[model samples]
Target: MATSVLSKSVLPKVPKTARKTSTKTAALQAQPDAHEPDANKTLNLILSRLDDMKAEETVTIDLRGKSAYSDYMIITSGRANRHVGAIAENVTKGLKESGVKSVHVEGLPNCDWVLIDSGDVIVHVFRPEVREFYNLERLWTQNPAVAAV
Candidate 1:
C-alpha cells in the first residue's frame, strides 16, 4: 500500500501586497470620514425631524460624559399613540437618509413610548401622559450644568 502526501504547492497563496492592501482598506473604512456627520450633526438632524413631526415638549440632554450608551438623549411628547409612532418613523427615516447605517427602534407596536437608538443619539417619543409619567428629563438632567435644548 502507498500513502499519498499533499505538497505546499497544491495550496494557493495570497500575495503579500494584496493582504496589505486589504488591511489598509479595512483600517481606512473603520475611521469616520469628513463626509460622515458627527454626534452634534446627528443630534440636530433628530431634533429637526422631531420638530417637523410636531413633537411637543422636546428636550435634548447631553449625555456625553454621564452615559456611554449615547452622546445625546432626546425626550419628546406626542399628542397620542399615532403621533408618537409618526415621530419615531420620521426620525428613523431622517437618520437613515443622513447615512446612518443602523437605527434600532423599539416599542413601535403600541407606541406608548417609542425608543429610537441612532448610534450617536437616543430618542424617546412618548405620548404626553407617558412622557410626564416617565419624566426622563428630570431623571437625566439631575445636573443642571449639562446643556438642554
Candidate 2:
C-alpha cells in the first residue's frame, strides 16, 4: 500500500498595519546618511587601524578638492608581502566592524600592493619596495601648479 504525505501549511497573512510599519521602517533605514558614519570618523577609524597594524611610513593626503573618488588617500608601507596583506586585511575588517557598509579590496593575492577603498577613505598597503616605486603620496600630494606646468 502507498502512504500519503502531508505538506506544511502556508504562512498566515501579515496584518496590514504591521506590514505598513515595517515597510516604513525599512525605507527610513535605507537612506544613505541613515547608516553611513561621518566621513572624517571613517578616516580616523582607518588611520587608527593602520597604526595598530604597525604600518610604516603612513601618509595621509587630502583628496577632498582634488579627486571626486575619495576625500582622503592614505599610503602606508609593510615590511614584506605577508605584512602588506595582513595590513590590508586588518584595515578592511576594522572598517567593516566599525559600521562601514562596503569595502573594496584589490591586489591581495600577490600582496605586492593592496588597495582598500572604504567609501570616504582610500588606503594603500604596499611592500616597502612597491611603496617606493609607486610613490603614491608624492603623486597625489604634488603641487597643482607644478603638475599642470
Candidate 3:
C-alpha cells in the first residue's frame, strides 16, 4: 500500500511560543506622541523606529508639491554599514506591521546606504561619510529643480 499523503509526518509542526515586545519599543509606546495629523501616521511610525535604532542626523523634507512619488523624504545617517542595514530593516518591518503594503527596499546588501519607499514616504539610511558624499538633503531642500534631475 502507498503511504498516506495527509499523514502527520508529512505536515510541518509550528511552535506556539509567546512573543515579547522589546524594552525599547515598550518604552517608546509609553511616551506621549506629539500628535501629527492622520495623514502623517506612517511618517511618524518611521521616524519613531529610526529614533529607536539610534539613527543620526535625521532630516525630513516636505515633498508635498515637489514630488508626486511621495509626500515626505527622510534622510538619516547610521554609524556604519551594519547600522545602516539595521535601520532600514527596522523601518521596513515597522511599515509592514503598521499595515502599509507594497513597501519597496534597496541597497541592503551594500549597507552603506539603504532606501525604503512606502507609497507616502521615502527613507534613506546611510553611513556618515556616504551621506556626506551624496548630500541628498541639499539637493532636495535647497533646489527643487535640481532635485528633479
Candidate 4:
C-alpha cells in the first residue's frame, strides 16, 4: 500500500516505553527546554519522540497567524544525511498513522532540508548547518508568545 502520513498526540503524563534511544537528546536538553510544553503538548510529544529517536534541533513555531499552512511549524535536525532522512521518514509515517494526512513532503533525496507538509503542521528535518543557516526560529520570533521568551 502507498504510505500515508500519521499524526497522533500522546496522552498526558504517559511515559513512552520506546524512549528516545539517543544519548545526544538527553545531553542537549538536560532540563525542560522551550515554551508551552503543555499547551502545545501534542507538538511537544512529537518533539520528545523525535528527540528520543535522535532527532536534533526540535523546535515548534506557533504560526497561528504568521502562516496559513498550520498553527505550528516543527523543525528538527539529524546527526547526518542518513539520520535526517530517517527522522523525516519516521515523522511522515507517524503523522499518517495518526490520521494527520501529510499532504506533501519534499527534499528526501538530498536530506539537507526535508519539508513535510501535514496540513495543520509542517515539519522541517535539516542538517545542523542547514538549520543554522536558515535559523527559522529567529525569523519566527515575531509571535508575542515566542517573543516573550
Candidate 5:
C-alpha cells in the first residue's frame, strides 16, 4: 500500500542555528545587487533620452584599457541625415546637463557617423550602413564580457 501524506518520512532537518545563518547569507548575497552602481542603467537612461530625441541602435561597449579613446564606447544609429544631426544635438545637451564638458563632436555635415569624444566616454552616433560596415563589435570581440548595451 502507498504511504499516506501524513505517514511519509521527513528528510533530515537543518539545525535552527544553521537555518538562521543560511538566511543571513542569502540576505547578504542580495545586498550587493541592490547597491551596485548599475552602469548599464545609467547608459540606458542616456540612450533613452537619445531615443526620445530619435537616436537609433544606441550601443555602449566598455573599453577599459582596450584603447586610449575612453573607458566606454557608446554607439547609436540615426535613421536619416537630419536624424543624425538631431541625435548629436540631444546627446550634447544631455551630456552638458549631466556636468560632462569638453565634448569634442564631429561628422555632422554628412550625417554619416557623428562621434562625440567625452573624456571618459566616447559616443558614436552613426547611420545604419556605416555602423554595419564598420562592425566595431567584431573588432573588439576580445573583450566580449563587456557588453554593448
Candidate 6:
C-alpha cells in the first residue's frame, strides 16, 4: 500500500568506501530541521540569496497591514528564463535548509515567472518583460497612480 504522499524522500547517499564511520554518521545526522523561522529572519535570508544570485531591479513591498497572505512581498528580475528558474530554486532551497515549512512554488516549468510562497514571505522571480507587464507592485501598493489632467 502506498503512503498518503505521492513521492518518497530520497536519503542522502552514504559512501560505503569511506574509511571513517564517524564521518558517515555525521553526514546523515546533519539534516536537522527546526521550527519555522521568524519573519525578519526569513525576509533577510531571501533578500541575501537574491543579492547573491545577482537579481536585478529588486523591489520589496511591505504588505504588513495591507495583506493577510504574507507580511512581505519581494519582486525581482532575472536576465533570462534560466536565470529566473535558478533564482527561484535558490530561494526555495535556502528556505528549506533554514527550516521554513511547507513552502509552495509555482510557474517553474515556464520560468518566465516563479512565485515562492513561504507563508511569512512571498517572493516573485520574473523575467524583465513579464515583470513590467504584470506590475504587481502597483497592484499591492496603497498609493494610486495620478492621472495627468
Predicted candidate 1: what Cα RMSD to the true structure? 4.5
Query: What is the Cα-based lDDT of residue 36 in candidate 1?
Result: 63
Candidate 4 wrong stretches, greater than 4 Å: 1-45, 142-149
Which clashing pairs does model 5 show? 56-77
Candidate 2, 1-149: lDDT as tens digits: 12322222345567787766676688887777665777899889989988899999999888777777788889999999999999999999988888888899999999999999987999999899888897877776676653233
Report clashes for each candidate as comma-separated counts: 0, 0, 0, 10, 1, 0
TM-score of each: 0.79, 0.76, 0.72, 0.63, 0.61, 0.72
By lDDT, rank the candidates, best first: 6, 3, 1, 2, 4, 5
Q: Tell me, what's the RMSD of every candidate? A: 4.5, 7.1, 11.8, 18.4, 16.8, 12.8
List, residue by residue over 28-131, the lDDT tens digit for candidate 1.
88887656678999998998898898899889888877876789889998998998998899999999899887789999999999999988899999998888
Say which prediction, candidate 1 or candidate 5, comes out ahead on TM-score.
1
Candidate 3's displacement at residue 147, Å, is: 3.6
lDDT of 2: 0.84
For 7-120, candidate 6 gives per-residue lDDT tens digits of 344445567766466876888678655577978899999999999999999999887766667889899999999999999999999999999988999999999999999998
How would you encode candidate 3's per-residue C-alpha lDDT over 1-149 as one tens digit per residue? 24666666786765544256778878998985444223399899999999999999999998888887789999999998988999999999988887786789999999998989887899999999989999998889889787665
- The residue-level lDDT of candidate 6 at 65 comes to 69
Per-residue C-alpha lDDT of model 5 across residues 83-147, encoded as one tens digit per residue? 88888888777766665646688997888988887666777887899999987766676545443
Regions more than 4 Å wrong, model 1: 1-4, 7-23, 33-35, 143-149
- lDDT tens digits by residue: candidate 4, 45-108: 4676687678865877777766654668888889899998888888777665555533488999
Clashing pairs in 2: none
At residue 10, candidate 1 shows an lDDT of 63
